[model samples]
Target: MADSVTADPAAPSATRPTGDPLLVLSGVNKHFGSLHVLRDIDLTVHRGEVVVVIGPSGSGKSTLCRTINRLETIDSGTITIDGEPIPAEGRALARLRADVGMVFQSFNLFAHKTVLENVTLGQVKAKKVKPAQARTTAMELLERVGVANQAEKYPAQLSGGQQQRVAIARALAMKPKALLFDEPTSALDPEMINEVLDVMVGLARDGMTMVVVTHEMGFARRAAQRVVFMDAGQVVEEADPETFFTAPRSERARDFLSKILTH
Candidate 1:
């Protein structure tokens, strides 16, 4: 149920010397019945790092994101946040989830709750923050995401873009150490994509550690310190955004870029 795969035994235990990585995945592997979803994945995300994961459909990009937060349990692998291994269940897992926020493509907001209520719920219930303080934090996050004016509105009353921004605000209210985004803008209309991306860019600039699964190369170019390319459940290449876009080392990555970029 748990294991680790290291690139080199001689390498440092953690990714960097300054401090422990914000997130670490060692020899991570997962499967669903007969299908192998992630294979020998070794990745490390440091504090303040913005890592963008890009891959073709069915390549396990979203699975990779989900596993980081234990939404999809790995068959065998170790995931650590802030130097501690993730627990399999119970209060420990809940605490880990609070520390690692996630935003999905569907903008999973509570339709029955107002925008402010949606953002405050998690902080109040899970984080045990006082109701008044939770509301204050929620308002600040909504304003930060540029949707405070819609605080009283329900999810159904907002545009897809506004709803997604509310989702982001909800995640921020948790004050997570890192955020995992599963194609955050994929479901939005073309006109709405930039609004969401702008908030994400601001978060990156503010030094929010993030692992994003997205095909939006423009966002990657502008925001990512590193770009990871995955294919068929394995990471084929990783590099700085400039090099990844201009001269990808792998043929798979080159072909992917060609197809996605041309259109």
Candidate 2:
């Protein structure tokens, strides 16, 4: 059976989570050559809220997540984290990235570095922390994500799930206020997906504001406070999980869910 993501007292919705907006995207548009990838996108993720973005392939879900950390630039619109617009380039952009962590579909670990090294490098280099202090924080995060025992091994020595957990640990080492996940489980083996999802679930329970782009309906339905459906680069619907899963208001969302749930 697949892993379940059911709400409990610790879930965002259960607590009626609301707070200062952490990430805001307004009138966001992006074009790759003649292809319009993102169109008039408007979305917000508040502190301690989990907003899951679900859509079919090529619907701009991944691009939207990437834009939050400025990994992908936009042709128009405004994106702000903690109410400040992202800087074009420089130390400001780097600091902005440090403030918002991102995990991609691929593990993206350094092949040459040990798991511990990978987690601590950013803190030591970017945050100007001492090596010992960085390692301490890295170990805590590694332990938090259930991968501390794998710290001495290089990325290639660990299983895919272990590597991904380490990636999550690396992100958390930055102490980012919000995290973005783009298809976090898409590249995982069937058995490994749950381990990563378990880590994510714990983060949600601990009040980590998150924006996730994924097709994992169970996680979205059970973990997210709101679900946003996108199609052809436009947001088609947004609703609480129960309503979105049972009685989606938009035809596009209904059609999309029908195709997804039937399989």
Candidate 3:
């Protein structure tokens, strides 16, 4: 069976798209002491778009995702999500985070929490959802990720794939307007990679407004609306998956593609 998400563009919500992008980064720069990790970055993500970012290790892909949620602060420029500029700190930053969910490469579930608890904790504490209400919503998200059967189990009791699914469910419980995935399947065993990718592919098909950083070529080709090729802290090329795979425009992109495909 195919795995894909299907979101209705006409869904009514006060915070829904106004034909403006859900995410925008303009002239963004980030530095770690003397090292320039990201520079003059400008990008935008629309309401229902899936953008896949690919690059060699240490090429700033992960740092870029971090900067979006302010996990790694930008030294210059700005990041705006859902029409609000990302505040530097305190309540505003926390509120912005609640609107943008993130899935890390390592399944970062609380070891002591059950899958259900992991999913509900954020909603209850951050969103002020009542316990009963949070549990119900958590179950719905767990079911959506096909992990309802494991909802009562601790993260340690589940396989890597199961744990990753729970991580995804936890992110979704926040009802985020956009999702950031940082190599979601990179740490999984080879045999378990597909299951997690399947869930992500489903989200993309549904138009969840995602930005994913991964080296999964097949997933990029089949599921992404646009593929961004980055190298050495810069976006070298951006194209639809078809052209990105077959007709890369930049020399850096072409070189990167050759190494990736030849490996």
Candidate 2, residue 228: Cα displacement in angstroms equals 0.6
Q: What are the per-residue Cα lDDT tens digits for candidate 2 across 13-126?
A: 433557877899999999999999999887878899999989889999999999999999999999999999999989999998999999989989989999999999999988
If scored against the real structure, what TM-score would every candidate get? 0.93, 0.93, 0.91
- What tens-digit string does per-residue lDDT give for candidate 3 at 4-36? 111223434211342458899989998888888
Query: Model 3 — TM-score against the truth?
Result: 0.91
Candidate with best lDDT: 1
Model 1 bad stretches (over 4 Å): 1-19
lDDT of 1 at 66: 96
Off by over 4 Å in 3: 1-19
When sorted by lDDT, best at the front, the candidate numbers are: 1, 2, 3
- Model 3's alpha-carbon lDDT is 0.85
Candidate 1 lands at a TM-score of 0.93
Predict model 1's lDDT versus the native. 0.88
Better of 1 and 3 by lDDT: 1
Candidate number that wins on lDDT, 2 or 3: 2
RMSD of 2: 5.7
RMSD of each: 4.2, 5.7, 7.3
